[model samples]
Target chain A: MKAAWSAEWLKLRRSRVPWMTVLAISVGAAAGGLFMFISLHPGRAGDLGLLGAKAQLSTLEPSWPSFFGLLAQITAVGGVIIFGITVVWMFGREFADHTAKDLLALPTHRAAIVAAKFAAATVWCLLLAVYLTAAGLGIGLLLGIPGPLTVPVAAAGVGRIFVTAVLTIAITTLFGLAASVGRGYLPGVAVLFAVVFTAQIVAALGYGAWFPFSVPAMHAGLTGADGPSPVGYAAVGAMAFVAVTATIGWWQRADHTG
Target chain B: MAVVQVAGLVKHYGAVKAVDGASLTVAAGEIYALLGLNGAGKTTTIRTLLGMIRPTAGSVRLFGTPVTADARSLWGRVGYLVETPAAYPELTVTENLTLMARLKHLPAAAVGNVVEQLGLRPYAARRARELSLGNQQRLALAKALLGRPELLVLDEPANGLDPAGVTEIRQLLKTLAAQGTTILLSSHILAEVAKLATRIGIIHAGRMVTEIAAADLPHHVARALRVRCHDQDTAARILRQGGYQPLSNLDGMLSMTDERAVWHPDEVATLLVESGCPPVHLAVAEEDLETLFLRLTARGAGA
Candidate 1:
């Protein structure tokens, strides 16, 4: 397992996909800062043109809580696409590069390889989440939004954002499974888009709490703060477990013809 | 003990039977070459043996242990390069080899030794994607040789290699065999296989058509004596009178496969000369591997 982990880590670090994902999350954080900038000084709306005019309609208060909520919302939505790519690449690249066959007969267990892949994906996704949070903090401080920015509020806000990121990351285990079964990134990326679209429809129909994909978005206040119940979080956990188990099971048992 | 024992193995993917009732044993220290055309199930059989594909029937045993993905302990003794070799395109050659060495539980120094052994020291710092096809092949061979595995399963290890590289790998395989490392490989290069393998298995349409020792290949090849004489009719008559069955091919040359005729072609010439039909061309020809392979595979196909 250690060997597999080391190899997986080395592969992940050398890939450009991680850097691409980091760039994506940083861009999202920068956009979040721009929105805060517009909201903080709506008096200059006419001077800044259409974007500023649009920002004039902002309902979010110029406060730390709102800033954190905006960051969480970005992660919940954008993170799925970015982090989903990470998981997909982690599993899909083996097949795309024609390397899966070499892995199948290794002395190390297949489950260990699968576990190591997921471990690398999790760490990678978490790093992006951390980057988004840190960038959001930097942007907020630079904008100098009103409010004390109390430690308790900051901690709570960061905690909530991370929880949302973790939940979003958890659900992406299914994308790994999809990539393995479908034998490339296309299927996993297709699944990601389909799930994202369906989650929006389902959540808009008032079933966000029950839908695992929507639960994270709702809890992050993309929907209202009357967010997911404990049952929703449990459902997310259950779905994550099922996805992880099913992915490992597929790796262990499937005839790896690729 | 045999290094590999495959018994009545069958693998069917949907309606196609990729491998049907194939069986062979590769004893320790012997280079067993599986020869086949494309889609003849050679790759499928190798996959089944490595547990990369589950057999629909029969079983494979390596070193007397049944092969399964769970047979982790059994795998430590084996190294395999199936189909085309693959490596992380983004990683350097050294990094890729080091990763494999780690996976194989070999010392970190094994990477450097294999790189040197495969003549890849200059390319060690190059990314895998940047290497040419032949260099990629050498890198694959290098990975397989790491830790000096007790058994090597290579599929077309000579693919993409230039003549020199091919000779180098052939010698490498020979050295490994001499050191008691059992090798089971598949290649379409019959000439090379004839030179390297101790035994060869010809597979056709998912079945093992024949297994013959490399040393006995010449014996198995069909040999015939061709006689073209001044008077072919008289030569045939004299050959028939001499109790030798003579058959004429489309080229109008009288040919005889009878052991008596092939073993004593001088007797046929003497008989023909005495009967007023002196031979113009009389020579014995033995079948080469290509001819034998074609004949056997065509026969198998017809059957």
Candidate 2:
């Protein structure tokens, strides 16, 4: 297991997608900052109405720190996109380039490879999430917001973000495994999107966000005052169970031919 | 004891049987070559042996132990290079090796030795994508050799290699074999196989048709001697009367075969010279691997 983990870490280090994700998150955060500045100091509301209602109304009080918080939420979505690409490339590239044959040829168990990749993807997502959260807090504080940033609030925020990132990674890893085993690209992305979209709809209907798909969104939506509901925990648990089972099954049964 | 043993291995893709009841053994310190045409189940057999694919019916044992559900433990003693070298395009050549070494849990000092040995030091810092195809192959080779595995399974190790690269790989394989590393290599390149393999197994349409020793190949493979005589008509008549089967006329050279006895080129030359029929040169046309392989596979396909 240690060797597998080490191997997984090496794979992630060699991959470029993680750095690209970091760039995307940083860019999103910067754009959020710009939007906040423009909304607060708008020359004219009539001229800037085209941006969005959020931008127009964002001028009320217009605390730069709060704007950073909003950007953090939006950038969290970028984390998902990054997770998607990482998931796709990690599993898909093995089949795309036919390296799975070489990988499977290693004196490792079939299940270990799958588990290692999942662990790697989850850790990558978590790391990125923490970075984004810290970046948001730093930018918020730097921009001179009003409220004192308590350690508990920041810690709670980071914890939720971590959970959300893990859930997203788990869901996407299954998609990746499916894509790899199925030997295709678009199908995996489509399935992942479908699951996420369905979960969003279910959560919006005043239902519990405890479904496997809803965990990421729930994590993203929960702020300092909005702790996780009992249903959210159930949803995360169920999804995790499904993800582990599906990954193991797919790795064991799917063809590892290059 | 055999280092690796495969028994009645079978794998099917829908209606097509990829590896049909194939079995072979590799003793320690032996270089075994699995020779076959495309889709002849050579790759499938190798994959099954590595436990990359689950066989429909059969069992594989490595070093006297049945392959476990978690195969990672077995990987420590094994090195494998698939048909095409697979490396991380985003990583520099050295980074790729370093990562593999770390994964294999090798001593920190051994990494540099492998890099230098594979001639990858110059390209150490170049991203894998930046390297040429041949360089990528070199990196792959370096990765496989990182920990000096006890068993090495190479699939088409010389594919896409220039003559120099091919020679280098051949020399490397021979050196490893000399060092007592058990190697299972599969390739369509017969000459390379002939030069490196101590034992050869021919697979035709998902089944191993024959296993032969490299030294004993000429004796077991049936071929003919082409005898050129001073008079074609006299030679043809005499050969017919002597119960030899006439093959083809290569321009002016006449080909004949006598399967009843082992062909001695020197004896045939002496006999032809004495018969007043060998005024010109005489040569023995023993079956090369290409011909033998074609015959074995063609016969299997026909059946």
Candidate 3:
């Protein structure tokens, strides 16, 4: 198991897509910082208040922390998409390049390989999420947020984002596996999109919020003011369960051929 | 003891029998070539042996242990190159082999040595996709040999290769065999198989038609004598009437087989001369693996 994990890690390190995504996230986060600066400028704030002079301009104090939060949210989404794309690429490329035959020929257990890939993707997503969080916080401090940082609140927020990123990564990786081993990308992506969209609609219809697709939104504190539903936790657990089960089924039963 | 044993192995896809009652074995240090055309169940059989697919009906054993369960444990003792070389394209050649080494749990120190031995140092830093098809194959071979597995299963390992590349691979296989690697190579290339295989198993329509050792192959396939002459029809008629079985009439030349008949070059020349058909050439030709393959497959087709 350790060997499989190490092998997967090495492969990920050699790949350029991960680093490229990280770069994109950094750039997007920096741009968000610039946008916040322009929006919070004193001149801009005064001009915006002129049209409706009765509008409360005093409540419009844009703190550096707010900019940090906005950047963090954007970067977080970027990180999720990056991780999702990696999952899809890793799973789909093996079939596309006719390399699955060689992959399955390794002496390691098939289940171990699948688990290792998912673990590697999870670790990558977590690291990216942390980096984005830290970058946001660092930039926030530099731009003159309040002194004496609230480490506990920041840590809690980061932790939730990390969990959300992990759940999303797992779901995407499973979709990749299904796409890779089943047929090709379009079909696999189609199935993934359908499952997620349908789950969202079902949750909206009050069927139940405990679906895998709803976990990330809930974790990000975006689901209505119901305050972090337990459904998100359940969704995480359910996705992890289904991902493992589907991966095992794929490894054991699918024809390991190109 | 046989290094690999498969018995009554069967696998089906929907209604198609991909592998129907296929069974064969490779003994220690022997190179067994599984010969078949496309979709002849060669790949399916290899997959079954590798535990990539569960057999619908049958059993496989490595060494003396049953392989139904705990098949992964058995994989450490075996190496394989299935169809295409499956290394990660994004990884450097060395990285690809190193990853495989890590998977096999080889000692950290030994990984470099194997990579160097496979002559992979030149392309060590080059990503897999950057390497030529031959180098990609070499990387795949390097990975397969990482742990010095006792059994090696190679499926079309020489698919895309120039003559030199083929020779290099052939030498590598020979060296591995010299070190006691029991190899099971599947290919449609008879000449390549003839070069390395100690034993050959011909598969047709998911069934084993013949398992012939290298030494016995010639005897099993009948030898024919070619006689080129003018007035081919007259010579052929005489030969046929004189108890000779004509294999074919090749454009005014005659090819015939007669188990009990001996053709002294001078005697055949005299006979053809007397028959007003002076022979220009007379040569004995032994049947090769290709002919035997055709014959076997044709026989199976008729059945």
Best by DockQ: 1
Superposition error at B278 for model 1 (Å): 0.8
Q: How accurate is candidate 3 locally (lDDT)?
A: 0.72
Q: What is the Cα-based lDDT of residue B208 in candidate 2? A: 85
- State, as a TM-score between 0 and 1, how close model 2 is to the true structure: 0.85
TM-score, prediction 3: 0.87
Model 2: CA > 4 A from native: A34-72, A105-116, A138-170, A183-185, A203-210, A218-229, B227-231, B242-253, B259-282
Fraction of the true interface contacts (Cα pairs closer than 8 Å across chains) found in each model: 0.75, 0.57, 0.60
Q: Candidate 2 chain B — worst ten consecutive residues by lDDT sum? A: B259-268
lDDT tens digits, residue span B186-222, model 3 = 9997778888899989888888877889777767777
Question: Which clashing pairs does model 3 show?
Answer: none
- A1-258 per-residue lDDT for model 2 (tens digits): 676777778878766777888898778666655555555556654475645655444433456345544644564466556777777766777677656665564554556777777778777877777777777667666655556667765666556556666666666766775676566666667777776677667766646345656556655663333535777777666666776678677766666676
Q: Candidate 1: which docking quality band?
A: high
lDDT of each: 0.90, 0.72, 0.72
What is the interface root-mean-square deviation of candidate 3? 2.3
Which candidate model has the greater lDDT, 2 or 3? 2
Q: In model 3 chain A, which range of ten residues has the least summed lDDT?
A: A51-60
> How far off is residue A155 in model 3, in Å?
4.3
lDDT, residue A129, candidate 1 = 88
